[model samples]
Target: MNETDAKVPVDGSPLELALTAWREALGEAHVVVEPDALEAAQTATFATTQRIPAILRPADTAQVQACLRIAQAHGVPVYPVSGGRNWGYGSRVPAGDGSVLLDLGRMDRIVEHDEQLAYLTVEPGVTFRQAHAWLREKNSSTFITTIGGSPDASLVGNALERGDGRGPHADIFQHVCALEVVLPTGEVVETGHARFPGALAAPVFRWGLGPVLDGLFSQSSLGVVTRMTFWLARKQPYLREFFCTVNDDAYLWDAVDRLQALALDGTLKGSFFFWNDLKALSVTQQYPYASVGRTPLPDPFRDQFREGFGRWAISGALSAPDAEIGALLERRLATALEGAFRPVTFAPPPPDGESHFQGVPSEANLAMAYWRKRTPPPQAPDLDRDRCGFIWCSVALPFTGAQARRAVEIADRVPRLFGLEPNLALLAHSPRCLYLVTALAYDRDARGEDARAHACYRALARELAQAGYFLTRAGLQAQEASPSVRDASSEVVRRLKAVLDPRGILAPGRSES
Candidate 1:
């Protein structure tokens, strides 16, 4: 048999043997072998980017178990696709060689929603929109749930990949309460409180009885997540939202510092992000002040505008009564904007309301609304020259503004040192945890975009490794290429793979061997 050919029993009876075993293990209707069905199952959010080899849509956990059992018995590789909407990351397709896609889109259902406890349990295939709708129906007054990527993205996939979003509850990993995973050996295993016998209705705790195995599954090429439960922040009594622009070059660090202070001091309650002028212009056709019918800044006034205005915005309910929301906002704004850019305050549009500042979705707003005007669909800049592929490099550093400034300085100079333009996006994960530095290479499809991006990435990866910057899953591929960065931690992760997935069948092409 060819090396890439699906391994089947040698005797002419092997194919028959496998088919009979699968049918007996799962009902005939649960097995899909038709070419069109396979093709449809393999479709992904970023189909324009990656290629999908084979797709298997199992009807239930039993079918999934049967499929995996067959794959392992035959030495076939399995790539689990929960929603297939992980756009920039590997998407929903497998990254390994000679792999068969295992799609869980069919198992989508909200298992449970405990409004009294402020938590929801859902399957891997549940989309953010579905979860949001379920939560709205269950508790109209519940706090806004966290969401990542697009509304169509899967909640389980987002949580497993540690997706980030806006608001105080943006860190999805922290919100994860429990998980139901299917091990590689075709057995179902529940982690955390769900593991204990008769503990179905027990309180959700991410870590408890023993070592946390849930963390191992996250970003790992091991088990597939079938279900998960996550805690949601309860709705606060009062809410306030505001946007601050920093156009002056000198205030760049000042802005980072103020935002960091507010977040650390518990004043600002949402994830904070900084956008460059180019990125800012891409999102809004009219400046917030100008769009509201205020006097427009003259062209000569442009130079006075901060070089890179950090959209230092905050979103969260106040701990105090409704009457105190305004005072809290003013105090937070005063401390965060002191000696920095001019602070502008605005009320959050009603939940059903909209604002150019926060109403539009951030990710889509940046990808579609902002850049689409200058470049048409599929017209992203080339990945070579002035353009480099963006990598998410989040490092835990001091919470002070100086640390944030250093991060920006490194982001700017590092790309330029490799002969690429400095186009970086900064996001403050939390006041004390880590700072996310996203280096944007010009879109590779754009003219003269290829060479610089590749070279810059290679160079930047090496520099970051030497600088002791720990890489997250977002940069896992790039980190593997650097010797300095691939250490014992990564080695142990690999060894864990060999033990959990002895057959090397799960997500075969994604991480290093």
Candidate 2:
């Protein structure tokens, strides 16, 4: 057989044999063997060596079950992806080599929605754009929190990765209930009250009577999650876009300290963020390669930019039941950070409408991935196709000024050492913890830059882990080499993987314990 050929004799190699079975299970059109399809499936925002032989697009849960059964019987590994929009991490690339891409994009479906109770059930392929439109069509009173990702990104995929976003339920996993996962062995199971024969509140209740199985499927390689439910935040009568700027690092750290009180006291309504000047710049425009004539922008440019952009900027929303409560929150927020930060600013309360903070998806932030690209960003930017090198190195730290300062000092140096600028942000997920999210954006097509970017990620991840901070979520690149945990903990996880996926036919090396 030729290098690109997928066909073979009636009885052939494991992948070919599996492909034949897959074509029978799902019509040949869905069982794609096109070389271009495989090539696109393996291409990621960052460098990847995995070669996907084919793609299997399952239309529903039952189809997914059939696909898994064939893979199990044929002993061929498959990697499942919901939307393939996991940019900067791995996009849709599999963790291991020679794995088939199990694309679930066709299974997009809004299974159930309840406006009064404020929750929605979604299939693996439901995107933020689709869900937001549904709410608008119904003129619903509640909205779900959305991340600063592509609108096409899947909610189930993001929740399964435990991604954090803007709003009251900023911690995506915390607000989610009932999960329907398809194990590698082709066994289907439902969690929470959904497991009961006839529980009306199945999707509403997070914890069932017995042990919680929803958590096991998240951030693990044991199973593929086909369905999930997300709790919505009721629309408040009053909303204000809140923002602030701090010129000095010391003042920024102090502001972080004071902000925790607001977070703890129920003043900061949702996921607030503090991004450095570079991150802010990246979002607005690409690298000033013409003006600066270099990479890893010089300190002079940073200083000049900081003079106008501030050293660090804070942003989030103030949501309240009434304007009276909103005014109180405003006063409390200002009083809390009075001397610690620069004058706090609020966008003049706009007339009541679909608040962006309350789950309206945006493609603006995605422009950052093209920061280092030489050419102008396309109108519809797809980072993987554009070869935009980006990686998210996020670590959770105690919500304290000192912790923020330490993380910034540590994270800022490594990227620059590799001749790359550090695009960093501090995202508050809760009262007790703040997530320091760093972006390593580069030009992969540039000479030797791809290897450098990957190496920088490995070094960055290692040093951060050594500093007593670990990743909250990682892509395929970071899974294999993650810092070691206690022997007992690692052993238990591996043993569980063994029990759930004996043949390792599912996503292997993903979220390696």
Candidate 3:
């Protein structure tokens, strides 16, 4: 290769050589080689740490392809991050050390929004808040499903990760129609019908004529998703938020059974969540470490919380075209589990209430991360700045009440044994299964807190896995928490990786298990 084609380094390290080539491919202004920035890029939201050489900010698909080409030519690994707000899952940190972070934050663009079709195509950098605002500005009657994540979190990134939220299309990945992926070898590819020229139904239909390749890109290291079209939920006339409580474990299990049936039958068309008191308290207020002394808040305080909010709470939206249908659905929910749960009530959207179903993103859920912090959290909480350590172990469980009860019992007990509060919730995204999401919160500055948090998470994960409950999402620390992969399946994955990314230049340690 000539000098003009690519930089040839003689004295500098491999990373330095790669940096030179990247700066040329993407403008120097787009390349981040500063030590402080590189260190920040290597830091996840929790205790795990890795050293990334540099960060390359790609603006568009062409730039992403160029960056990948440069990395392939220089024999340097590249890790792609859409928004760097992965939080409990390893934020912007690369899977392996010495890799350069491929940050796609600059590609924020809403390519298309068809109100009649109820779909929106966006770049990887488009955030939930941005898309919500865009729809309102365009006077569109459709909205995307938003998660309880940071407002800055990428819409495409979260969907590709199969993140869940509260809406008609709460299962984010299922709503994605097509993807524009940049392969490891610097080739650009489009999933679904987008591969064909002038594909009119690319954004309308999810599956193409032949094999469905969209699932391969999500939750895997096969390719980098540059663009995605999401099927948006329609904004109906009659909309109301509902809330109910379960004061005891037995009642909670029964309620889960009833809710499962409703979800499966489409009575509860919107997604809902059942979160424990600990999760409820963390979101409302910080842990009273000074008054309670970390002794599991006094029984009196617990009683007060139970009287006001119950031991566990379930919240979701009931949206319909008219009041009569909405009332029918509410009546169905009321009679399904009569007297099993607290008084179920539906109210108008409060002035300050969250509009998550309408796709307005908020960071209120992030308060759980700062539960152990002494200082007050800011408007936009920063986990690293507040020294709040967090790790999320989200496992999939059957929709049966028996499975939920056992999972809750194990989740509640394991963290207490490790001197940590179990902030747990059951996200019922699908009718057949729910994600039992548990968060391990700790103070990073405290002595041995990091190590303790990791140990607690590992034990919790192991116990859950042993009980036949395996994680749906695995971070760097809990990658092994997944069920044992069969030899045949493992070999198939290895062989596919060898063909797609032979050098493993794309996230070497990012396990899809």
How close is every model to the real structure, measured as TM-score?
Answer: 0.79, 0.97, 0.95
Tens digit per residue, CA lDDT, model 1, 1-513: 223333333564534455566667666765555555544433332222233444566767777888778877866677887877665443554665446677788888888766677777788888876766666666544443454356667888887877776666667787786777887878887787788888755446677578878887787777888888877665555555555666555676666666666777777776656665544443444233433322222333333333445433322332334646658666767665665454655565346322212212323443422121223433342211121233344444566666666665666677656444344446556677555444433444445444455555556555655665544545323434544434588788778888878888777757542
Off by over 4 Å in 2: 1-11, 340-342
Give the worst 10-residue stretch by lDDT in candidate 1.
381-390
Best by lDDT: 2
Candidate 3, 119-184: lDDT as tens digits? 999999999889988888887878888898788899999988888887888788988977999999
Q: Rate the local accuracy (lDDT) of all candidates.
A: 0.58, 0.87, 0.83
Residue 369 lDDT, candidate 2, scale 0-100? 94
Q: What TM-score does structure 3 among the candidates reach?
A: 0.95
| Model 1 regions lying over 4 Å from their true place | 1-51, 200-203, 285-321, 352-363, 366-396, 414-423, 439-452, 475-487
- What does the lDDT come to for candidate 2? 0.87
Query: What total of clashing residue pairs does each candidate reach?
Result: 31, 0, 0
lDDT of 2 at 217: 87
- Best of the two (1, 2) by lDDT: 2
